[model samples]
Target: MPELPDVEGFRQVLLTCRGRRSVTDVDVRDAGVLRGVSEERLRKELEGRRLGKAWRHGKWLFVPTGDGPTLVFHFGMTGSLRCCDQEEPIEAHDRIVLTLGGERLLCYRDQRKLQGVRLADSADVDRILEGLGPDALAVDRDEFLELLSGRRGAVKSALMDQSVVAGLGNLLCDEILWRARVAPRTSTRSLSEKTLRRIHAAMGRVLATSVRDGCVPPRRSWLTGRRDDSEPVCPRCGTSMRSTRIAGRRTVWCPHCQN
Candidate 1:
């Protein structure tokens, strides 16, 4: 699954590969990856327009064109943007391709096609983003505390709620809880002020590290780094790690480190 860190990495790819480049052609090999736009319209609206700027909000990536519309992308499970030469063979799963100057091609490839692309104007972007809460990476300590204080569900569940804080997925929610020494199933309303503060701090720290590394790297000292072992053990205390579903996603935590 592409989380905040993964989307941030994609934003970098877009900036480097397609920014300011003129779209010479828009080819939609699989229209299933498009929403509210047809193949002909996609080509008509996007082709020949210059990619003006690219920005990411939560899990969404927006690539705007000077011609008045922005290309929106959401990678549901296995979507990514790739840059390759025109001479290179088209990938089997490539759904959308934008041919650019210098023989460069920007491809939107997704195996599952769970989420796809859209064309939006500035007005449309505002409407789509109106319901989302402050980004997990951008929320302040006070805002995070206030948001967490009102939730009655498990801390892990609250963390994964997009309305509470956007951009945190299952892995990030569990990892942050483990780092903050809070159990995954702990009730959000039962948390103390100090614990909430620690959780907020940990969220920022983890996001920064993951974005810097271009992924949520599981280090030997980190629970994520060790959670996939045949017999995973807590890095801090040798106790076996636990795994279960919380908020409908596989959750991992160290019993010794958390709770």
Candidate 2:
């Protein structure tokens, strides 16, 4: 699934394609990827509006068009945003296309159609985002500590819960736990302040690098890089890594390093 870093990259794509340009047309190739709004309404609302500065919260991307409705995107497992030349071939998965000033195409491509587009007013946007916690990229260490301190459940589960801290997916939670040398199954309430601080620091470092790279990079030295090996080994301790399901997601951790 596309995580926070991936969604951030999509925001950049939107910004690049929408710079000072008005939407010349709206084409909904697959209405299955749209939610709450009809194709006619989407076209009617956004066809000629100028796109404002796009922003992201957690995994959601919001594109405001001046005083009009906001265009919201949630890139599910196989969704992405792309900017292509007007003459370029549209991929089979390009569900929605926005012609910008008739000069370029902004495409919303999704293979799975699990999540897709929505049109929201200010109040609707608020209600849509009301269930989410503080964005992972913006939460401070003290706030992170407090959020986890009040939670009960495995530490990994807490991290993956959007209501507890948004933007962390299975991969990010595993990477953060591995870097912090904390076991995935450790109880949130059992974590000492020092351990929680370490986890927060690891999250910061991991998110910083991931955001810059636009994904959780699979660098050889990182656990993410080695998780898929035929016989995966801990990059730090060289012990064979362990894999199990935690919070209903496959988790990879180093028994020797994280014990």
Candidate 3:
């Protein structure tokens, strides 16, 4: 799953490759990766428009064009964007291609063909994003603390809920919990003010680190580094790591360190 860090890296890809380039051709190899807009409409709307600045909110990437259209992309489970020359051999899964400025080609690739792309006018984009809570990277301490007040769900579930804080996925959820010394299953209401404050601080630190690294780097020091081991040991402590499902998503936590 491409999370906040990965999508932030993709935003950089757009910055380096597509910004200021005029779309000369639009090719939809697999229309399944498109939502709400048809292939014909996509081609008509995108071609000839110059890609302006790009932005990201959580896992969604927004590329605005000069013509007032925003190209919205949700990289469901296995989707990514790349920039290459048109002469480069296209991968089999590259679903959409935007030829830019007669030199560069931007490709939207996905293996599972899950959540794909959409085009929205400014107003439509606002409506689409209306229900999402404050972005994890953008929320202030007071807002974060207020959001967690009175919640009964496990802290991990609360953190991963997009409505609670956008952009936190399973890995981020576990990492933040582990850093805050909060067990993954600890109920939100059980958390004291001091502990909740720690969690908020940890969230900001971890998110800043991940974004700086361009992804949640799986370094030996990070919990992500050991999450997939068949018999994983905690990187912070010597105890064996545990794996379970929380909120229907696979979760990894260090039993000794998190609690």
lDDT of 2 by residue, 137-224 (tens): 9999899988988777899999998987889998899999999999999999999999999999999999999999999999999999
lDDT for position 205 in model 1: 93
Q: What's the lDDT for candidate 1?
A: 0.87
User: Which tens-of-lDDT digit does each residue in 1-259 have in candidate 1?
Assistant: 6899998998998888845789898889999999998999989988788887788888889988886689999998889888888999998899999898747999999999999999998898998788677888899999998888778889999888777788998778877888888999999999999999999999999999999987788898888888788888888888899999888888888877888
Ranked by lDDT, top first: 2, 3, 1
Among residues 3 or more apart in sequence or in different chains, the pairs in candidate 2 whose N, CA or C atoms overlap within 3 Å are none
In angstroms, the error of model 3 at 162 is: 1.2
> For each predicted model, how many residue pairs clash, with residues at least 3 apart or on different chains?
1, 0, 0
Q: How good is model 2 by TM-score?
A: 0.97
Give the whole-model CA lDDT for all candidates, comma-separated. 0.87, 0.92, 0.88
Q: Which digits, one per residue and each the tens of the lDDT, describe model 3 over residues 33-131? A: 989999999998898899989998888899898865899999988899999987899999999999999899999999998899999998978986786
- The deviation in Å at residue 247 for candidate 3 is 0.4
Q: What's each prediction's TM-score?
A: 0.96, 0.97, 0.96
Cα error, candidate 2, residue 215 (Å)? 0.4
- Candidate 3 collision pairs: none
Q: Return the candidate ranking by TM-score, descending.
A: 2, 3, 1
Q: Judged by lDDT, which candidate is best?
A: 2
